[model samples]
Target: MNKTLIVATLALTLGTTAADAKTRLLVNCFWPSSHFACSEVLPAWIDEVERVTEGRVTGIIPPKSVAPPPDQVAAVQKGIADVSVMFNGFFGESVTGPLVAMQPFVGSNSAEAMSRALWRTNREFFADEIDTVQLLSQFVISPAELYSQTDTPMNSIEDLAGRKMWVLPGPLAEIAKKLGSGVVSSPAVSSNEIISRGVVDGHLGLDPQAVQAFQLMPYTKSTTAFSTPIYSTSFSVFANSDKWAELSPEDQEAIMSVSGEALAAAFGARWDKAAAAAVAAYPEAGIEVVEADPAFEAALTEAAAFVTEGWLKAAADAGMDGQGVLDFYTSQLAQ
Candidate 1:
């Protein structure tokens, strides 16, 4: 009986050793297979990582794989998967500097400005939050717009009051609350269920491609262009801490070369392309597009200042000098 047990142990050890010898990377995505970024951004990244590493690394994004967006960061930290996106709202009550970029009227063109700011954050303030895993890159989603069930235009906050609107966490929900809407936060995966069942009168959480990806048009009759980017979700690529540690310095450098800010540049370019497709499809979806009056846009700017002050308070409590980071970030953006 002792001899037989020893043989079984040997066989199990050999099998485990063999599996560890092979290089593997498993990526989780927050969108379905149809999303341009999931299809294009992920595959190209896997190929580049493999090419740069000379086949020392390989990856796959299984179809319908990622569970939900907000849960993805925790999944990576627990080593459930190699890498995926994370929502900024989950960073507790404080840590709101990152949330400032999401405030309405922060910037109309976030692709460039926000992406650079993220690169800076990763190099500086975010190390502790992301210490569990190796951070590859941080980037934001496209600008969010209001999608309504009727042609009642959200031209002003007064227009948004006394109505129901769907909003996710972070500054978007805060904006919705200030506007007097009953806020509803839904996972991207479950957006269809809530929107279809009248869980919300309208949704303020989607970018353009979201209209088709979530099949939102069935519940949407109109869309209002935000005065500026209302909110942009943050995403980061992460590898399990143990897996990252096992790699050599050369391999680590290679990973950063192919991932992180390099990949972030690719992310911005891809969003530019996807945004065009989303804009083109709005007509076919029979959704009316409306632009807010200039006066209304100015009022939103004032509300944004109020929210900005709150973010400063939150950031200070987090032990980060809010004014310093914000000032540096905006300066780099200007230069």
Candidate 2:
């Protein structure tokens, strides 16, 4: 008998059923159980995997996430969990490739398009950077808009001078510094407390849905909506390489067929809807959403050059064609 069959016989002798012989994948979800990723995306993906594989593969969520957000990639790579999704920037300098998606004003306003573009770009140009884990998909969320807690909206570059704003580390902080704004570096979880206590005058890098999610909407007086998004976060759904190798070739193909760009599009579309709904409800919460005027656009155009150049320099350090990636991304979004 073949070694594979022999192993199966041995496993059956150990009192495991035939159904138990199927490969089981454990998805370590970092978001809260109530979060959309946990409540919807994972479940739907699991269903599709099962259906496509004819029950040869199945997936389950753990009682809780195995690791925090920043540790998710390592957790999956080391096999602490078989699968997980994580934001690109949360890992800091260790991650590469997804940086292209995080750039300001490069993506389509349509999250679905941006998400698909990210997947395609990563596959074409940066797969080596993320080969530690098996990538199932890549995606970008809806772009974030700037919000101010005060009644006076920030409309121009001059308006940002000396104004304190909470910014997550990355391009946003760099942009804030370039504009001569005081930067208050804080994680998203702590933003509510910091902003509520007036520790900062406003914040950048969150969409309307996030503002509501973080309870910033109640405190926000006006939102400065840029024609292009100020920035978007990149995310990946991935699996442990060792775990992936254990699956049958057919099962692997089945799982992959339903993942990647397909899953990315789903995530992007859902996020876009949530952001739109949140923006629609802003007036009921007594917050004004202001579109950026020509002057403000001119200033943003000038300010973005610095952050973009910095990203390109960093990309070059990583031995990547930063400009090529950016150009490709723009063309993809334009489509």
Candidate 3:
């Protein structure tokens, strides 16, 4: 073969190899495409990943294709998808300790603090607690506060008590009970059907965008919070262990770089921003705003103790040092 023929062949081979070397990952998440968690965070994450990978990795997220957000983890675990985002709270009856995010006053307003602690805990504690699959990172939801309709103000435990209140199952209701409020397990209902029907007076949730997405806040008249927030929600990004193993070392490292605490904080900030936007919309939306009365706040803290006890017990059952996990989480936040 002549020099020209050899050079031509080499160029073609190199071009093909460059393109083939690119790694492609399909990510699945439960949030609707419009939701910031999905639209902003995930899309921004893909961009960051691509930029950091220097074109060696690319991602695809079929916005609406992932189905119910609650089932995202199952889809990934079943190999229906390669990666997914899931909530420990959503795991339902199984009782994974990290879902403790559902309990009030357990988290702070700093997403970075919560994320790093959660990531660390996953390696040391959650690893044994959750054996179903692999965890990339854990993140906290924005904030959990009380949002009520205009007719009534949640001024004190007495104001909240004797009133029909909406609470998510698992850990959140300990506060409502302490406040002497009737617990109603229907956030979805409050977000849609129940609020419109006047079944409950208030809803507890964070991520202002979440309320907007569900359109539940439109019916709410007021929100009660410390401004710094009492607690935050938590969730994680994950991959199917089997599929994760199939990737090359370079690919794994590239993905891992995007995991851990930093990502958690970044995700957390987005929630804060979203929540702030929702809070600002209160007056325009005909929603009222009130500080949680001291009595009610005190009662809330007292009731939350039970949730901690329950979590510690559950963690012990799962072979973890609940106090250690709690200490790590709380200490990391202070740092």
Over 4 Å off, model 2: 1-20
lDDT of 3 at 283: 75
Ranking by TM-score: 2, 3, 1
Residues 213-273, model 1: lDDT tens digits: 6778777888877556666666666777777787667777887888777787678667766
Give each model's whole-structure lDDT.
Answer: 0.72, 0.84, 0.71
Question: What is candidate 2's lDDT per residue for 1-335, written digit by digit as tens?
Answer: 99999998998777656555788888988877877878887889999999999988899998789998889988988888899999988757656678898887776577889999998888777876877888899899888888888889988887777589998777788889888999998777778888888988888987767888888877888988777887888998999998899888888898989998999998898888888888888999988988898788777867887777878888888898989888887878878
Candidate 3 lDDT for residue 292: 73
lDDT of 3 by residue, 221-317 (tens): 7777663466677887887888778766776787678766667777887877876787678778887767777777776677567777877888788
lDDT of 2 at 300: 82
User: What TM-score does each of the candidates earn?
Assistant: 0.83, 0.92, 0.86
Off by over 4 Å in 1: 1-22, 64-68, 93-97, 110-113, 124-129, 197-200, 332-335
Q: Superposing every Cα of model 1 onto the true structure, what RMSD results?
A: 5.9
lDDT of 2: 0.84
RMSD each, Å? 5.9, 3.8, 3.2
Clash-forming residue pairs, model 3: 30-69, 141-233, 148-221, 149-221, 150-221, 221-287, 221-288, 222-288
- Residue 241, model 3: lDDT of 85
Candidate with top TM-score is 2
